[model samples]
Target chain A: MLRIILYSQWKWSRGWLLPVAVVGFAIPYFMLRVGYSGERYWDAAGLLEQVAAWGRGYPALAAAIGLLVGTSAWIHDHRGDHVYALVLPTPRWYYVLLRYTAGLVLLAPAMITVFLGALTATWFTTLPAGIYAYPIQLAARFMLATLLAYSLFFAIASGTQRAAGAVLTIVGIVVVTQLLAGIAGSDLNVLEAAFDRITIWPGPLEVFVGRWMLVDL
Target chain B: MPTMKLMLAIAFLLALPWRAMSGQAQDLAHVIDSLRERVSFWDSAAGYYDSITRADVDTVRVGGFAVITNGADLAAVEDAVNELRDRFIPIVGPDTILFQDKYFAVLGRGSHVVTEDIILAGLITDNITSQLHDAAQWYFGSETGRQFQSWLGPRVPITDSIAELPGIYEVIVLSPLTVVQRCHSGDIDACGASLALGLHQTPEEALRAWFNAADRRFLVGQLRPQWDYDLGRRADQTDGERRCIESESDADCVRILAGLYRSGMDVEAYAPGTNFHPSLPLDFATHSSLAAVALELGGDGAYSRLITSNALEPEARLEHAARASIDSVLRTWHAWVLRAAPPSVEVQPRSAWVTLFWVVVTAFLAAGSSRWR
Candidate 1:
């Protein structure tokens, strides 16, 4: 049953995942090529700055890949209104697990490519003294960040149309509140406050913040 | 006679056009000079306009200090000023006169006002409380008025909500200095040395006192821009500077560092935007955190004692104020700094477990979707 679900997920997402994987591989490699090119390799501070700029792409890529895979995991079921899923012999929770597991397994190709790219970039070059590479750590962070994003969007997408509508309605209310606050000359920014809560450390998006350097001191 | 007459006629004809061309050239030069003067006038006018606009800044006075800000940012500026007063008064005592009538600008968040003090901008703007907290440190230093250097870092409370200390924690953990390492490893005397509370010397002597030979040599490389600029300005490079960079000589490094001071070279001006202070060992936050520990130990009037102590050395002043041994004060400070250490880059086990828990919970939530039912 898991194998069948995995095959279906692969067929559905392979087109998108293939390009994502390629990009994932290219980002770290290109970062090293551009960041540490020629004389830059000797300039430690400048190299670190360049590496930091390149590092921004990882969390964004992770979030994007998560959304794409998560949405695809349930697009077929949502379109069919779950008629196909309802006929499976396994329990509903068990069937959902199969689908979730398959989607997670499918993320491996992207993760592996990023890891390999980082390894090739770091290990092949002699990093300046005091600066070190963290390929495993970067890959792990990317994986966790992806998982978090996937779970969030997956939970939302797997719900009924009414559930999706309710989520949209809540978002609309927040936007309206912000507009009212602005008109009323209130300094209270509900959206900014909410964003800070969600993005700061200990928040769900904590993994996306802070230094994401593949090579750092 | 006819040949002579013809030659004289040719000479007169050539001289006539030469006079006309010289006159035209003079007119063109006069026009260019006039245009240059107009450009200079406009340049000065632009500068005058900028100064006038800066002078027109709105001032909001609260708690013995004036907050200078552009009119647009007045509301936020007032909040920050009030925050500073509420937080600062307790540590420095209400009796101290703070910058009486002096203007201070709250610069970040697009607020531009001119003042003599350091501009609080960049990362500090992320949290207004911390921003004002830093401003209060500067103001308090001014209030204390050069009679005493407040080796006591930022005396204001680091806002409890922020996850990391704005800029200081990384230096504590990652600094290559032996004194900082020793302080981290529970050496009280080293903590005193690292904090520079004991040494009240010239900047060069303070640098020598704080960091050892290797660290000084290492710093020469780190502060390359300043060293390079200082050397570049001279007709010839100093032998010590050449030896310091090329041969990695510590003696040469020391000589060059001292020579910079003797030459009255303004290295900070040369290396713009670099916090390349030779005298200060640790950051202000680290110093303030230690002071906070002392004040906490000394109870009420600790700040008064700290401000009024006759002791020349800061460590003794701290002891006099805290009413405790310098060793005890330092030990407490070290512990506090370690406790306030920023979050590690490595993913913690607890975070990993929490992430897993969320994954499962969200998976269960998806499973319970109404469409399946």
Candidate 2:
């Protein structure tokens, strides 16, 4: 039963995993080339500036990996109305575990792409004194970011469209409330308040906020 | 005969628009003579004048034909050019005066030869210093001022609410120069000193003391013709009145069409209909003092010293402080975005090769399974 479940998940995920792996492998190398396009003397400040500018790509790569992996984890189950999954499973938690593990297993290739890309990008560039490359560290961060996104999206994907609508409505309501508060001059900075609440330490999104330097002190 | 003919032509030229001709010609001739006398001075200053002309000849042309002609003949035309040169002198002469003032302000007085060299050296040094100061002040003083104020007053409080609250003592010492230090130190004494000095001072005195530096800096940076939304609005009103008159005229359609065409292309045709020029309702010094106080309260180390030592008025100090705080916050926010990291997960030694092999195998299996499904 577990083998069958794993095989089904593998089938659904492979379509997305292939293209994502290819793109994922290329992103770091491309970023490295673009960053070092100018003169031979690599000033530390200049290199850091380039790296900082290109940092946005990391989240994007993570998000793409997450969305693809998350969506693939559920598509087949959704298509078959989850009836086979419900009938064959010894327990609901057991079935979910099987699906989760399989999805993670399938994500391995993309994670490897991230690792290889970071390694290649770091290898080609000669960093200034006091700076060191952490290709493994970067790859680890990428994987964690991908997993967080994948898990969140997977949970959402498991639910009905109505659930997504409810979530969106809540977000909209919060935004409108904050904007109106600003207009009213109430001194209640709701948007900022909410952002701080979500992005600060101990927050669910906290991990994404700190320095993600591939090379750092 | 040749000399007589030249004299006759000069007399004729002198007779027509004598006032205009004499003033212009004499000024130009004087400038030419000065240029000849101080060839080195002309060589050094010529590049600066040329740059200004290149930057603003078209805009200057609108003031009058003479302005443009004078600027173009800055290096060439005689007499009339001297008067033209005088105008440029007033603008650049301020730099010399400012240098003198800064030297006097800093060194008090020195020996005659030393003072003279100091004045010259000061001019060059002060020129760069004044430009940087002006750029910073203008950036804080313009529309960005409001944004900075908002960010400082509201956004910062919300974002970093957990940070230590500003003390009353710190609020009092808000001077232009020390604001940076006070903010950095997080000490309240500096803020107290500013508040004590600035809060009740007369507007003019305050302006003289605290706001003058920033004001001078701002004035230096402002481009000519002076952009004022109110003036733009008045121009717009006049354009509207003209359009109405045209509508009533015989060439209404043609005039309206022409006006529309001009409006579409020419920015001057459609002026701004608002009073957007930055005006300090509070005396300059008071504003400076306020900025100084605010900077101390906000803990902005980089700018506090400049703000407090500059002796800005309370209001200017406060305004500048608020602006600096906002700028600092925005910069910090930008930095945060740049520094954000991805997630982390450990991998096996052969993760790359193994993952690739598995991916290929998985693809084949998935393809076979897809057919079964």
Global lDDT scores for all candidate models? 0.69, 0.45
The runs of at least 3 residues in candidate 2 whose Cα sits more than 4 Å from the true structure, single-residue gaps closed, are: A38-42, A160-162, A185-187, B1-373
State the lDDT of candidate 1 residue by residue for B168-215, as single tens digits: 444554566777777767878877888876664565676677778777
How much does each candidate deviate at the interface, measured as C-alpha RMSD after superposition? 4.1, 14.5
Residue-level lDDT of model 1, residues A64-173, one tens digit each, is: 98898999999998788888888877788788888889989988999999999888888887766446788888888888888988987888888888988998998898
**Candidate 2: lDDT of B272?**
32
Per-residue C-alpha lDDT of model 2 across residues A1-217, encoded as one tens digit per residue: 5677668777776777788888878766765666654321223434555665666677677778777777777787778887776667255555656666777777788899878878887887766443567778777767766766676666666666666687789889889998898889888887787888755643444444544555532
Chain A superposition TM-score per model: 0.92, 0.86
Per-residue error (Å), model 1, residue B15 = 44
- Poorest 10 consecutive residues of model 2 chain B by lDDT? B104-113
Top-scoring candidate (TM-score): 1
Clashing pairs in 1: B153-B288
